[model samples]
Target chain A: MTTDDLIARLTGELKPVPRTAVLRRVAIGLGSSLAASATLMYFWLGMRPDLMTAMETTPFWAKFVYTLSLAIAGAWALKRIAHPLGSIRINLALMGALIVAIGILGFMQLAMAPPEAHYYLLTGHSVSICTLNIVVLSLPLLAGAFWILSGLAPTRLTVAGAAAGLASGAIASLVYSFHCTESGMPFIAIWYTLGVLVPGLIGAIAGRYVLRW
Target chain B: MNPVEARLKELMLASLDGDAKSYGVLLNDLARHLRFYFMRRLADAHKGDADDLVQETLMALHTRRATYEVDRPFTAWLHAIARYKLIDHFRRNRIRATVPLDDAQELFAQDQSDAAADRMDVERLLQSVPAKSRDLIYRTKIEGQSIAEVAQSTGLSEASVKVGVHRGIKAIAAKLKGGADDDR
Candidate 1:
């Protein structure tokens, strides 16, 4: 159908978004996700005195570092919040940074000492399992993705969100390629797509309530 | 314009004058108009960017509405909003600049399947030539406005319009052929 037909069909209910409200709503979303991530880590790895005591002995700082990094990054991103730039320059710029970081991490993996029994804090049966731990460790960055998608700009529908998600998924897969082993690409692609899809959905749904302006 | 279209136009015009009824009308009109706009685009697209474009346009219209002069033709204002929104669409989808760590082809080729996406690309090649020249084609071909109307409208000699159209057509034809080859 044509745009005219589409308009004719649903002409009575649309509302213009207010810019201030959208910004406020996005801030809330970011704040909530930050709280949730912290809460999750606290329960999973931090709250228990016994766990913390054991963790101090374990000498493995992966989970703690990852969680701490997430909180720090969230604070850093929140500090930079300002007016929405209608241009996609910022989105493209962030995508570039993600790409570079992925490459740097990839090179680090290749240059490092050969296989240790455990890739991170967790033990995995294979590279795919190890990759999952790495993915989990990237939560702070994933939260950043949420912030970007939510705060960037509104799209036409869920489709735009989906497209953005896929673009992100693809770009992320590219970055992951440089740091991850050859065996990890396909699984990374699939899981990364899933990871990106969630934000796209949130953005699209919230676009109705938050990003209209 | 039908009732809804007429109503929207009136509401837009009235809203300019600070009529509260018009504001509601505008929102209703927008909500109604956007759903179909997004839906149709989505229907044609292999990817659902049509939806994203819709919300973005709606959001932009909301953000940028203050810049619109209530005195101008509302249609012109509406079309302008559409054009800017389209510009944003291109910016989002275009090749992102990055530090080239990998082959350009590899970075682009992998994980992308936009070839499967079918968004209408209305690149009317004839539009690029010139409106003065296009007048000839419109008169003789599209509009059937005779040579006399073409001359009067453009303030050019009829003979000149005819000659320009002929030259324009030849150039366009060659360009299309080249474009076709490039596509292959």
Candidate 2:
């Protein structure tokens, strides 16, 4: 068939698309996955035992803010990348700055503490399983992001995937924090960040194939 | 934004509002723009692929129309999609930009010959088609041969020749429509 024929067929079935359709899909995708991840975490690890006291502590809030901020930044970047010709440089830069700031905070805390406590601060109690838990938690969100993106127009598939992964990973870390008892800035900076990066890397690699549409 | 960009953006917004006439006009306008855009960038040997690319890009645009943000520049979005289609075409066909030393002078030649280009395009289009259907299409469509003549020439029945042409066109159309679904 000719191009004009194709255009005619396309225009023949016109329907008004809601202005908020894309955002709504994004919200549904991430929100539902987040709910699932939370449920999974609740059943798997349960909340930290000293939940009330932890809520009052600065370190808990610090970890909360760091992961939440990263999640927001990732979502911001994902929104931009969902559109054609959208750039994620600003979002990436902001994420980098957030990580760096957290890293410095961790270093400062380490410097103030005596040398004997350095290992404890860095390793925490669950260093072996912390990153793995966060990654597992992010799986649902990552799948949801990929599903949403495949239906959208993301020109840079790799970057779009990475953004989706980053956002999902950050949110996973946020959920994991509730159950994690570690209060060290250094542990959160190192292990939590690694958890987020693993998903980011997975997204970047898988996106090239999954985000083709 | 320039006047053209402003006008196209207006039409696109209208199209998004279920205005079929506006959407048709916008697509018609985009088809011409994309044709020129692809033709200028494609190599001489692959010029025939421009129409296919144009159709594929338009299909992509139609399927992904919801991704267009009303506040952003429409032209920029269009350009990005167009560039992506071109890149995808190059990757699929493995078309290199290298010019043979003997044919270097052809790069500067300004001959606007249509027949030769059309033949080249027909050849490129048939490259991936199955050999039997490819030959049938080449003979009946490109060489202006009758179905009976192609059948006799290839020792196949006339019914098969007709079926071959029909299936070949359908295959090409299906290839163009691949991955153009909304998937929602």
DockQ of each: 0.05, 0.56
Give the CAPRI rating of model 2: medium
Candidate 1, residue A81: how far the Cα is off, in Å? 14
The sequence of per-residue lDDT tens digits that candidate 1 reaches over residues A1-213 is: 553444333344344434254445445654564455445445443433344344454212332332233233322332222222223344435544543443454445445635562243122223444334333423443454445444443334343333333333332332332233323222322344344334435434543333332
CAPRI grade, predicted model 1: incorrect
| Candidates in order: C-alpha RMSD to true structure | 16.4, 15.3
DockQ of 1: 0.05
Off by over 4 Å in 1: A1-19, A40-89, A115-153, A156-213, B1-184
Residues A1-213 of candidate 2: C-alpha lDDT, one tens digit per residue? 899899999999888989988888888888999999999999999998999999999999999999999999988887788988778999999999999999999999999999999999999999999999999999999998988887788888899999999999999999999999999999999999998899999999999888885
Per-residue lDDT of candidate 2, residues B1-184 (tens digit): 5667788899999999999999999998888777876787788988999899889988988888898998887877787777777776776688765322222122112223554697686677778689888889889987899999998999999999999999998876776566255342
* Native interface contact recovery, model 1: 0.00
